[model samples]
Target chain A: MSEKIVQTSKEKQEETSQQISRQWKLSTSLGIMFLVIFMAITVLNTFAPDFMTFKVIGNFTVTYLYSVLLLYIASWSIVLYYVIKVTTLEGASI
Target chain B: MIEIPTAIGMVVLMVIITMGIAIFARRFGSSAAEFYVANRGITAFQNAISLGGSYMSAASFLGVAGLVWLYGYDGIWYASGFFGGYVVLLLWIAAPLRRFARYTVADFAFGRWHSKSLRMACIVFTLISMMFYVVPQMVGAGDLLGVLLGWDYTFAVVVSGILMTLYVVVGGMRGTTYNQIFLCIVLWSAMFITTILALMHYGWSYNALLGDIGARIEPGIWLDPLNSFALALGLVLGTAGLPHILIQYYTNPSGKAARWATVGVLFIIGTFYMMTPIVGFAGRAILGDAAGKNTVLPLLGQALGGEPLMGIIVGGAFAAIVSTTAALLIACTGAIAHDLYVGLINPEASDRKQVWIAKVSTIAIGLFTIGLGLAFKGYNVAFLVGLAFAITASTFFPMLFMGIWWKDMTDKGALAGLILGGASAILIITTNIMGMHTLQNPSIISVPLAFLAIYFVSKWAGKMPDDIDDIMHQMHSLHSDIK
Candidate 1:
């Protein structure tokens, strides 16, 4: 296979400076979104001990489903959202 | 003399197969790419498996279940930090890092700053993290063998150390990559088999299992909110800074490929983590109070499916240790041989000479870590891994984060952050070991301090790389190409 370093065209360069800020905004904003939810769950699990232990379904309590199961679901949803959005916004994926 | 034949048989086969692959890879892996990064042609799926395999270690495979059995919800919350880390990587670090780095994290640091001292500082931080990282796996491997296979701990550690050193020297990264992929399959399959059997034993009801566990163990018994908070901080940030984990992503053919692979990594590890708690709860409900902290998986295997099941989990444990220890060795070799010997001492060195240095360095590192393992017998495996992550979070996480995004990041700023972050973290860990015991994980204090150090020092230092804009374009733009 042949190989060469990437050289951005002048038009692409202008486009990319805009893209970088947009991508950074998207990546970081989504990243912060995930971190905040995780930390909040941690605090709830830590301090609100009685609230976390209330059984809502069968033996599955708020701590088990909301803190762990839902947190995992949210984490995956964020990861997939990032992938799909990046591909849609750009012709190529970053 | 007593032995668990099923476990011994399967584990022996695993060792033989990996040993065979290492020898086979050594014969043909002559080029820089072949030895260093699997010829830089690993597919997304393969890289994903390797990434999961490298990260799983004994801590994830065995310790997660053990913790959940012992501490209930508190355990999974602490362990989830490992998964929490990749979110940071997927967002901020993965792509730009792959595009910017050539061989190791030092390459990325030096590429940004063009300072030999900064590169050496990168190596120092990498070495400290890798040393802390490698010992736990080594000690875990020895302990697992001694408990299950009945081997002497010293003999078990020495043999595994010799095997790993020889495998790394022969196979390099290419061999490590393939071994990691296969080992990942073995370990994940073991988790699947054990968890499925436990569910089946409990009438296949998730509710039934949780009902039993909640009735038996009070949720309040597992609460340590402060320690959990600190641990979560360390794992979430420290994972992004791991030296062994960082280099594997750079092995991808392109920056985009690395990002794509991470999606799979999250899914794979996420699935594995979800299953671990089941095994933990199952062990508690079924075994009553018979489960030991790290022995939950193997014991659950015995209770769930007898000796064959136990064998698979035991073999899976060995695979987890071997894959992680080998990755650490290769990372150590890259630091000493590729970064130091080739980058500084012999810039004009031949390909064969570079490979030779890497082999010698692997031997030296293997001996040093094995000695540490034998000396610190019976140390908690998960605690050491968490400490390693905390230090990495304190140091490398800051350097990589700012170096990629912040344009004015100067060499002096980078070095200052590295020293301050790494030294402070080590001080905390040392004092904690010496009974200071003030904080379980210091990342809560150290991570923000390191980030602040980089920012203020860079602002005051007043010199930035001339090609900062071009480098940024290479990392962020679609037109940025890879060779």
Candidate 2:
């Protein structure tokens, strides 16, 4: 009975490892993507100031309101939604 | 100037409500587990509110607004980093940590490597980081009280410290958690109403205000990319390393609840942070440079709607300071009691003894912080908070992330990383404080050095625990059946 229990535990551990790996892959990729987007926006706003400084909306420049909104959407809303979706899906199916 | 009576009334009311909840929570806390983590019974929503309240701090409530009021677009980057940190927490650290760790981050480090010395190092760093973090909140409390109620700085600090200590001593994590939830609501509502009133002064259009602020920006001030990147990086990485913030995960019922709490934190804090920029912009456009920069929001409240609104805003800011200070105090107390006294000196200590030690530690830390807060009365609250973040980012972030993800991490590497990272951060910040302007954001250099220290030292030392694979497996496994 103990041998069978150990065998089942090993199987569960392996299954958990696979699930965690998949989750890590998704989350890390999304995190890196967001970091890159953040860095890109910072660089664009820094070096090519004119491009981002131009009036994109009514008195709002590309750097002022637009970049912030873009970051919120891409980094926060999109990334978080996917992270929750992926993690919760695994939880549900399990 | 604030209307003394009204502001005093509102602040007193907030304190009464907060302490009432805390005293009520005391009934649920008796053992060390109950004291430290509320027996891990907090729901996702309550945990979220508590996390939001603890995370926001006076640094976010007043410092961000003050910075934005002072620095234009550059200041908003601070808010961005603050908000972005939760994303990192949500994806990387939150769930896995909740699943693996029982009490504190030190528990995980010790559990992984079975090193008493490593746990001691964690205690040292956690105390240093938390004490450093607490001073600013205490200072903000003193400043706000001095302004609002005509109290002396020392009196204000003592009052705030004693009140926070009472909450933690009486109620422990349960009390602190509920108090934090009430504080977050008060803080968010205050900021939201103030922002709306401020926007109304500009005819209710965010675009109009943003456009005007954008148009009025001085050439080089609004677009410094390097500093912006450094500030943003520090806020993001530093948050992941915060001892108080990370311990909030343990308050939730499960790893899944912790993750959901992070989601709730994201929306709750995101809304509060969004309001900061409006306050900053409005303060700049309407009040301009006339008001004391740090007191811009409070002054704006007075200017817009008189004593009643200003009292509400001041009350909210005070709650932000107290809630954050309470959280930091508890974190520090845990390090002393659980990590040091119980963990190292007296491993056989009973839970009742541990709880007593924690309560005593809370009082000691509170008194120590009050002294530090009064001494550093004139320092910028935001900048001081930034320095604390840099220290955490350098010391804790590298060790934690590597420990969680990499199987090759050794006790030797973690120790070297913590010592070197902490030393470098302190040296750089001290020099910067003492007039060396080149290394303002020490994390840009210190964090990388810490990571390299861990990486290179781990490779060279090549002496990991035999059960490292098993430890890693445990950390990765979603279920907690191994124990």
Candidate 3:
């Protein structure tokens, strides 16, 4: 098998590859958004102790561990789920 | 506490309903997928609910409330740590494990390494960690049943064991997931109603009520900072490595479903966990010393609506225990069945046979847990879960993190880390804190040591593997290429 033959399929492969990477980007973006929320909580807690007592923000942060765990776990779970949905969507497109 | 007749009747009814669900769900197990990962056919919505149920275990139920009732403001760490742990789970673990491992956690362990020895190492560590997790649930069930229904501690263990085993054997993951979903809904409604009632009693001013309750309790116990940090660290880090929670990731039909489920799970778990502290704090203000620490929840409910409400509250706590217990049982059995029995013992076993083996193994483990529960009936629920968290954080967390991200992790290094992690954790549980004596300010001496051992051992294992870059690419690979 010539190297050229392998090289020739690269374009076709890239076509599919581009599609897949887009999904990964979406998942990664969602993941980072969740991290942002968690970081926000940490920042709020560090800078503002009184803020921790506010019912909306403070209540969530005061019970920070639960909110963090639930949010992060759910977010990651969403990413995995998106993988499945994307796979199925691609399969259908094919 | 509830009377004997009511308690026994409640116990019997709960058992019968659970068994019925198990038997009905048996039809879903005709195929291997149904048995193992529920055929990877579980919808994200169903899984999201199930995840919420599984994650919110005895800790969220009895422990948080009890701590709030006992320690006042300081107890919020229980809720905070648990929620925070999910962030670590999202960032470091979860999707990657689900994406890579097709079989079990053991399969993931063996994927990069060529050593059968390393595969066995992962299995043993997982089983040991899960066993620690199980004992507490069993003990909690026994204690709760005994107090609520006046059943002998032994009888409670036996009954709970039998019911758990029967369902796990017949329904497998399908049964476990559905049961978790059912149980979670019941628990959530119960807590919500209780919280609302508690708020209504004091005209719904959280600050006023908290202040009043804070006044009643001893000064330092209600709002200590250091205690919060340690509790937060344990709960936050512990979720990343839990055997059951990680295993649940594998059951998602597709990676997308798993991610979607995470979104729903966050909302459900986030809302419920927040409510736990509220319920606990309310109980503190209302019940006070007239009720024991664990009695805070039930007493408040009873005070709100007398016997009928009390029964419902107790029932909700019981439901919480059952859902988490069932999920743990399934996760532990998967470790034995998929990791050891199928992966190591009979590598060539057909999928059907593998499912059957899992069912049978679940029964055996269920029986074993019952014995441990009876033996440790007097122990505290939070204490047992913390020990579980410690062991898991020590052993599995490092292994999972390093195994996925670090290419240089050798068989010898992993084995050493796991053994050291588990042994040191067990030593801490047994010697530094016997039974449940030191639960209040539990010793976390072993936690840092476990992480340190893995880091140093892996560093010494030598240069990175030749395929390190390839593995990294696989992890960072774009979904479009696979699509």
Candidate 4:
């Protein structure tokens, strides 16, 4: 009876760790996806320099509005999302 | 506006305070853990501030502002890449490395593979990347004293070198951490004062600073999609690969706190970086192209608020050099004493012996850094920093990414990638320095090649470690799971 209980507990632990990794995978993917969009904008800025300098609003160019402003906000947001999501992951008690 | 005597006095006071903190923190440095990661009891907030302090070297504080002042929109990209890197660390590298919770990057590889050669490889690469890193700080520190105190360059280098070595050898990581925390706040506040004064002068119009569009960019910077992309990639990934910066994460209390601290660093540093470009733009607006190379921040501070303000800014700049050089010296000490000596040469060594060797190694490595700095004094400081990042991005980032996330990675594969990746990156930089005009950065080519080297070599080489599942669980899951 004791042996059976030990086996059951070991199986349960494995399942829980697997669940933790899966959740990390989901959150990490979201962070990477956000990065892709940011990098895509950087690519456009380099390839389309003239367009990047286009007056988006009040003499501010695309590069300034996006690279200067949006980059900071996006990086901060995604990382915040990551931490919040990870800390709440089941079995990631940490 | 540039008051030499006041500046010298302020810097001298700052150094005295830094020495005091190091000496006081020595009580906490009796053991290896206390010396290395502050016994892993550092609060997330403290870790965050030191991370910002240790990271905002002369490279970020002075280099970025100078780049933006000279290159305009093109230069802002470096700061963006620098901040963008924290996201990568937060997403992938920070938690796992903290979970491993070892002394150095070399320890991670050795623990994973149980291979002495692999551990030695990491130590070599760590030292090499660090050597590349120290040159820039030495160069910057010498130049800073030269400008602020009118001291000769070599004399300034020697004085700064001895002062940095004294504190770290006595106090260890605990001392360095305290100094970094104090110094980063001082430096950031100095930048803050300069920014507010600049904006106030312009009636708080950010766009007013941007009015001179035609003269924004000099010839051929942040252009050429290939070059820009390469430079940006090196800048972004480089932060994650940096040994000193990543080591700070281990100071956090847990994996979760490490994640939080990583994000905190982005915000702390993010605000400082944002101000850098503004100060740069203000310099361009006020002084045009005559603002002097790598001296934009001090010059702008003097112009806006005159001598007292410039004195504070320059004093903060001195702190920047000292804090970063101390941080790097501690890292070099780790490469020698922790990673090489204890981990390799004398695995059974006592804790008391370990601490003693660490102090000796600190002096040796500190002197070596100063010697290299004196030798490489003529190179541009910013370019040297970029070279350090590129080599790190090429070698370590690929290895850590695969090791942390992929369980199938073999020791043989990692070793192959470590050597090939490091060699190719250095080859390009060295050749470029000899005037081949090799791409200004090597990350564009080297990162992919390094990843491929590890991938193909893993498929073709040594068997995976027997405890791969246990390692993965330890790195990815909660501590309870390992039980």
Candidate 5:
């Protein structure tokens, strides 16, 4: 009976460790994705001046004001998604 | 121009109000922890407002507007980068840093690495960055006084320094936080009203103003890809490493609170930055090139709303300078009293003694900054702030990032990285000051070199600490198991 109890406890520890590793990987990937998207947009606005300067409205350019707004919204969405997912996961575990 | 008597009255009223808040907060700061982190009891919303107030230095208020007025589209790059930095801070540093819950960044470094040398290195870099950061606030104070009350630059710098020192010495972190929140409300109201009035002057047509600005912007000058990228990179990464700003996280109740506060800060700062362009564009169109660059916003206020409105704006500007200067002084005091004196010299010192030492150091730092500010009068505030950011980005950012995430970061590696990164940044900035303008923002090169130094040195010279696994677990864990 004691042997069986020890074996079960070992298995549970392994499972917990695996779950943590998976969460870490997912979180890191999400972070990297956000950074890449942010840097790419910045690069586009910088290198492609004419494209950014394409007049969208009367005086607003594609890259100057509008693109920045889009990037801001996208970044915030990414963060919000991460925050919700992580909090839910922690809640479920608890 | 603003009448001298009105400006003096406005400034005096602001000083009295701030001092009153400090006196009220004096009771909360009886212990070292209370002085440093407000006993870790500040709520997310209040901390967010205070953070916004501290972050929007004179550089943001006067400097960004001036740059926008002078350079048009190229100038908005500063605001874009400054706002984008919070995104990085929220995702990368905020949660883990708060989990550590140390008094200062040096304390964090020492705890993580168990190396006195690394802690000393952090203290040096912290002091350098804080001193450089305070210079711009001093300069802004002098400029505001000169424009408003017609005072000599040196006299203005000295007065501003003394007022800020008094605030930090009396109230410490609690006082600074309350005063910052009050100042931010005043600042935001003034900016909103000014932006509205300026738009009204242009008949509420953003397109008309944009059309004028677009016509004036020289082709290719406004959108140099390399310079723009450099500016953005420096601002975003540099913000991640600022000692004074990072210390604010410790005031939160928990890591989660810190994260939420950053989210709040994002919105608060974004709204303020958005109004800057309107102010800048309007100033350019109405005030023209005749208004001195640093005085554009005040002059624009007078033009749109007359002397009474200008007085309000000047009061807001002084508040911005004082709030930022107080934060910097507090950070400097922490480095001396908590990090050096307590951590290194006398670990057994009582809380009362530590607080006393912090107050003394605050006054000393204030006097030193006053002299530097006087010497650098008429220098561009934004440019000086950029250099401060570069130094911090190259030195502290790499160390902190690696220390928190990478388990293999050895003490030796951290020390090497800090020395190399800091030295390279100073050399490049000094050379730029001496007219070698090729490397204006050293982070573009220095950060990578610092990382490389850490990586190679750790691989060859030393092994990770024995307790690193536990440290890593603590940093990565969702909640504290101890509680």
Candidate 6:
């Protein structure tokens, strides 16, 4: 009898030659953002030390409130976008 | 005004209700599937509430306010980090994890390699990581009872452990889910009422509270951009990799359910985190360091509207600790039952027997955690939590990232990473616990060393598994055109 093939669920591990520079570019952007924020903290700490803690600037502190607000909104948006993208792609193909 | 005994009764009532739900939940989940994962049938709405209950542990409830009370504005970092971390989880592991692992975190790792060794290695890592992690929750439980009801610390530990174990042993996942959902509601309501009263007492204006905070404590520390950034990094990245959070993916009935539940989780967690700072800042303005920093919310209640509101907020604090501890107990027990005995020791164990094993293991782990809490009494709980995160991120993060994306990862490579990363983190933590100056002085050096060890060892092996290309395709599903 001919040799039988044993099929498994996992795909073989091979380097994709598609050469996606986009992933690297995105990573670099993230790194830069981290650096910028880090430097911003240093500068604020040095110059506007009093402003670094939570104080109401009318309704919010420019630093603490802004950072929290941005992080909060960005997190939710990313989750929603990722979920929708995956679900749509899965449905369209499968 | 409410008396102390009345507060104690409400708290006890909440605990009994939690136990009742857990015992009742077991009836529906007669099989292993039902027991471990609520049969993967929990709706996003219910799951989201349970997630809220789990997420807002003693750390969120007490830790944030206390940090704020002491450090002032610097404390918001905890809320930001804890909430934002889920975003990272959504990106890094969420949908794919649900799609890949039909069982445990180890099941996914082992499935990829067809290696029992890899599965066993993961089980050991999970246990080590979770034990240190759960100890802090137990400590928080003890502290909450000792302070609130004037109960002895040991009594609190035993009380919390016995109730949590009863629910988990009898109810399983179904029981845990319902208990968490109920507790989440009670916790949120207590927080809302307390915040409003505190604000009303100190003038119901955010601006007024901020002005008071500004006048009393110098905003010099809060305005620093770089420190804020570092805090953000810890909060976001740390939250993403927490094992309890990662396990939430398994609670979904389908991949679609995970996506929807994430949406619900986002709203719930975002609101909760945002509100924490309010209570923290409000406490600073109204209570004026009455009882202590950590007791900001409790003090604010009593200072603003006398003992009755204090009783309610105190009840909420109990809700927070119970919900979090109960969830951790279930998750850790599930990891043991699913990853250890069934996966490694007995692969063909029946569902009935598996449920029995889970129940027994739940109690065993609970008792051990109680002993740990009593031993580490009054230790810096927040810092201990950070140490747990450092260990988790170091060990599981590398193993998981490589296990999913890199097919060339070998058993030898995995074993090396597991031993190196897990051992290093454990060693550092043990040293810190023993008061070692060099190890505890700076986590930065040790944390990176753990990751570097994983990478270098995996590379030093020098040869990829022959089936590398096939694994890549499975992970990316490149063959399946996403139309």
The best candidate by TM-score is 1
lDDT per residue for candidate 5 within B189-254, as digits (tens), equals 888999999888879998888777655432245546665666677888889899989998888887
lDDT of 1: 0.82
lDDT of 5 at B94: 79
The lDDT of each candidate is: 0.82, 0.80, 0.66, 0.80, 0.79, 0.66
Q: Candidate 2 on B1-483: residue-level lDDT in tens?
A: 454678888989988998899889978859988888898889999999999999878778877787788887777787888888888887788877776746887876787778889899999889888877888788878887787678888898999988888889888999999999988888888888889898898898977777666544322475355566777788889998899999888888777788889888988887787788889888888888876656888888888988888888788878888889888988898888888888889988987888888888888887888889889988876667777899889988888888877777888899889989999988987897789775567888889999999999988884787665556555565554221
Task: Report the C-alpha displacement of residue B308, candidate 4, in angstroms.
Answer: 1.8
Q: What lDDT tens digits, residue by residue, belong to model 3 across residues A3-88? A: 01112144544554454455456545665675565445434444665655444532333434424355446554664565566556
**How high is the TM-score of chain A in model 5?**
0.67
What fraction of the real A-B contacts shows up in model 2? 0.34
User: Model 4, range B311-426, lDDT digits (tens) per residue?
Assistant: 88777888888888888888788889998999878978898999899989998988888798799887876667777898789878889988987777889989988888788888
Tell me each candidate's TM-score: 0.95, 0.94, 0.81, 0.94, 0.92, 0.85
DockQ of 5: 0.20
For residue B129, give model 2's deviation from the true position in Å: 1.0
Q: What is candidate 5's TM-score against the reference?
A: 0.92
Q: Model 1 clash tally?
A: 0
Q: For residues B151-190, could you state the per-residue lDDT of candidate 6 as single tens digits?
A: 7889888887787777777787778888888888887777
- Candidates, ranked, DockQ: 1, 2, 4, 6, 5, 3
Q: Which tens-of-lDDT digit does each residue in B1-483 have in candidate 1?
A: 226899999889889998888877776557666777776778878899999999888889999899889888777875579898988898888888777647888877877788899999999888888888899888887888898789899988997898888778788887888888888998999999999999999889989988888643334455466767777888889999888999898788877788888988998898889888899999999997888887989999988889998888888888888889999888888889988998889988888888778888999999998899898798876567766888899999999988887777999899888888888887787788789786878888788888888888988884786666677777776555364
Better of 3 and 5 by lDDT: 5
- List interface RMSDs for the candidates, in order: 3.1, 4.9, 8.3, 6.3, 7.5, 7.2
Number of clashes in model 4?
0
Residue B87 alpha-carbon offset, candidate 1, angstroms: 1.3
For A22-74, candidate 2 gives per-residue lDDT tens digits of: 77787788889878877676887767889887877676778766445677767
DockQ values, each candidate: 0.48, 0.36, 0.12, 0.34, 0.20, 0.28
Error of 4 at A54 (Å): 1.7
Best by DockQ: 1
- Cα RMSD (Å) per model? 2.3, 3.0, 5.9, 3.6, 4.5, 4.8
Compute fnat per model. 0.48, 0.34, 0.06, 0.43, 0.19, 0.33
